[model samples]
Target: MFELIGIPPQALFGQLLLGLINGSFYALLSLGLAVIFGMLNVINFAHGALYMLGAFVAWFLLQYLGLGYWWALVLSPVAVGAVGIVIEKTMLQRLYKLDHLYGLLFTFGLALILEGIFKHFYGVSGQSYTTPDLFKGGTNLGFMFLPYYRGWVVVLSIAVCAATWYAIEKTRLGSYLRAATENPRLVQSFGINVPVMITLTYGFGVALAGLAGVMAAPIYSVNPLMGSNLIIVVFAVVVIGGMGSIFGAVVSGYLLGLLEGLTKVFMPEAANIVVFVIMVVVLLLRPAGLFGRER
Candidate 1:
């Protein structure tokens, strides 16, 4: 059967695992984008740059501060999130009353500035980050070899995604956020500081990107351009999932990742463009996205 398909089970399953890992990142990043767009109405092009910052911060902690992967896991996201809070309060807040184009342009410029600074300082070369000691090995799963750290990444990502979904969909704080986004004046009248909520929501969204960066550092080379390469695909994921639907973003991310993996197994040459192709199809069929409701 394997020969009939012209591929071995090991290779198929291996690609699937890799796809899941990539999907994990997509889900996390797109979730952040969805939250920010849904609440703040900003495109946030700097998200990828902030992601890079997270990985670099992790590298800096290990290199200069004599810290380890564990510390990086905890601190990197918080540090980048702090930067996000500052940007939101000082710059992004000013553009909120303006056209959405202003927000996109501002973040695009911010991304360029960030990427330029990092490239100049760190050089274009990639940095290495070792997997944590606890997750340094692999397991034989009868059919395929599973790396402990990779497995941890998938599990942790799923948990975080689920937690975020729950918070936004079911919690009191989420209710306030949703309400404020829909009607800031009314929500403000009810004594819920809408501005503060927006600020925190942006921070939280960026922090999710940072967390993904930290998770990715050990798996891929920590290069300045890493996020730039990945962000486009994530944006495509967002479009396919629908810009306004959180559930759509998460589900489409994983599904597309799996599809991409299958594409690699079946047609290696088409793998790179498969996501975009699917995005075009999805847009044509359902402009509001699979889970998005028409406004």
Candidate 2:
């Protein structure tokens, strides 16, 4: 019976829910980017490729090992994180002291190679991961029908994002990470193996991206290009949130998603570019980003 600007509540709320779901993915992926860039100072352009790898890894577990979603949820990230560790130790570390451009270029090239390999085999038709048995139903919300899996996604993603924020902003290990990034030699003097710590931090960040990928498998068609398609927007999110600002990344992701959802209902023509438009505005006003500190 109630409508805002002549638009039905169901349509508006549905778009909001959709925005929240997308924001969850954006938060997860951008959180990883924030961590890696914040702690390691590496501009990881391969993040999307790594995300794509996570989805494929989940698919592989399901198709080849009969592992199912739950197992893939755990294993895919671990696998991707391990790959991240290798990347850090073998290659990424070497460029730490160099220009940020180098790291970006190296990772970007790596992403291309990875995407090419997968595209060659998969042919980009895409694969689908079925919703788990426990999450295949829908709930009537009086106004809108909400799918169980979509609700699960929103809750779990918020939990994960909250947990990550707490870990980095409140805990002792988080302090150490912050310290090491600020002055590795000082932290090393405290007997912390800074290199190892940095390595693990990068791994953990990559794992977050992988976790996002696995969660997305059932909702979006699993394809080699999926990560690439979504990643540019994620990068925009990180920039708007403030590069390397953990809290900024989380908040910006959800905020942008909601804004995007609103745009879809009010002005469908601009929905696609709304996020970027916001990014441009944010940059013009505060180049450092909404939550980023000026160095």
Candidate 3:
């Protein structure tokens, strides 16, 4: 393979795995963004910060309380969601009446503050998370030796993405959510509590980010800046996938990951920018995104 493309198949698959792992983060993060935007119409620029916060919260839990990954998996989301609730009640709630940009700007500023504070204390150097003992090793297949953690991330991300899609698309709660978001007056007249639903929806969105962060903590360094670049890629992914479609976001995310992987094998230099290029092409082809309904 390297004879022809100047890259070995092993290296290619490794990058592909990297892309897929990155895509998992993108899918999870974007799903949260989509969920928040789908119902609340607020672009949560604080999502990235929230993700980083989750990792720190997990780290603190482990370091201070001797909690393990299982506990972090359970506790981190709750902590992050609490902060999200505070943010929503104190700041984001006020901007709902204004232009959508206000929410975005406010959240963006909040992200900067949160990230800056964490950096001030933790600095740019990231801390390491020990991989769980159960997921510590790799599996040898004929083609490649698959790292257990990477494989777990991909599988778990897909499961989560699928579950979210089903909940939003199939369940009664999802029906109310969609109805409320589409027309709060009508939904309220129908006796659903739109305000509470909106709050939970936001919490759910932030919780998803928290979960992603915890999953990421072991794989990547626990750093304040982790969310910054990842969030940008995820935003591009959401834009390309059609913000309205949960399933679309998941599928596009994984697909782009594979594509990025292939690019590394065939064209090394273009690998980094391939996702953005795809986003551009996607936007050109469908301004509303692949699954988005035209307004």
Candidate 4:
């Protein structure tokens, strides 16, 4: 019924909603990076590959095992997370005593290898995933139409992010996790099995990436490079929010998403680089990030 700055309500709200959906993915992916970096002190450059792996896992389950989208939703993360656990135990554990750059380099190389292998077999083309019948339609919300699957993605992403934040910020296990990262010797003295905790933390972190991949599979084509396409932007979001800041990651993800959407409406050309531009400003203004504490 009304227009804002000459843009119709449908166009404005539609972009905002699209932005929110993108933010949901950003929040999930960045949350995982924040957790891994904050807890394990590993840069985890392979996170994008892990995300791609998750989507591929889902597709594999469907193509090979006759599993459905629901099955992929539940199993893909677990399968990819297990892969993370193995990577941590077999490879990443050795880099713990080294510099952060080493971890980054190691993971970056691993990402290349994984992507190469998949590309050799699957090629660079994107694979299609059908949306579940449960969420195949859209709801007309007077001004704009909202896709059911998208709404589900936003709701589920928010719920998962909230649950993760609560578990890490408000629970006993989270305290132990924080403690182990801070003082491994003391935590180990208490018989907490610090190594195991670290391993599991890494697994859980990548699992978040995996879950995001599964969620994205239907929306975006399940391509090997999908994660690579988004990882940089997600990293920018984490930096803007504050590296290792859980609350910051979640907040920045959605906020940046909205901003990007708005930019698209007003300045389409700058939409792609808007997130990085904000990141540069944030870095210059506050090196520690919006939610990051000064170390």
Report, for every candidate in turn, its global Cα lDDT versus the true structure.
0.92, 0.93, 0.87, 0.93
Q: Candidate 3 residues 1-295, lDDT tens each?
A: 3668577667767777777887898889989999998988999889999999999888998989999889999899998988888788777888999999999999899999999999999998998899989899998865578889889999989899999999999999999998888889998998888888888888889989999999999988999998886888888888888976777788888888888778876787997789899899988999888778777
Query: TM-scores across all candidates?
Result: 0.97, 0.97, 0.95, 0.97
- Candidate 1: segments with Cα more than 4 A from true spot: 1-3
Worst 10 residues of 1 by lDDT: 140-149
lDDT of 1 at 203: 96
lDDT of 2 by residue, 117-185 (tens): 999999898999998889998998876788899898889889999998899899999999999999999
**Per-prediction tally of clashes:** 0, 0, 0, 0
The predictions' CA RMSDs to the true structure, in order, are 1.2, 1.4, 1.7, 1.4
Model 1, 1-295: lDDT tens digits are: 9789999887888888878877999999999999999999899899899999999999999999999998998999999999999999999999998999999999999999999998998788899999999999999877678899989998998999999999999999999999998999999999989999999999999999999999999998898998898899999999999986889989888888889988988998999899999999999999988888787
Q: Which stretches in model 2 have alpha-carbon errors above 4 Å?
A: 1-5
Q: Measured by TM-score, how close is model 4 to the native structure?
A: 0.97
Query: What is the overall TM-score of model 2 with all chains considered together?
Result: 0.97
Off by over 4 Å in 3: 1-15
lDDT of 3 at 204: 87
lDDT of 3 at 137: 90
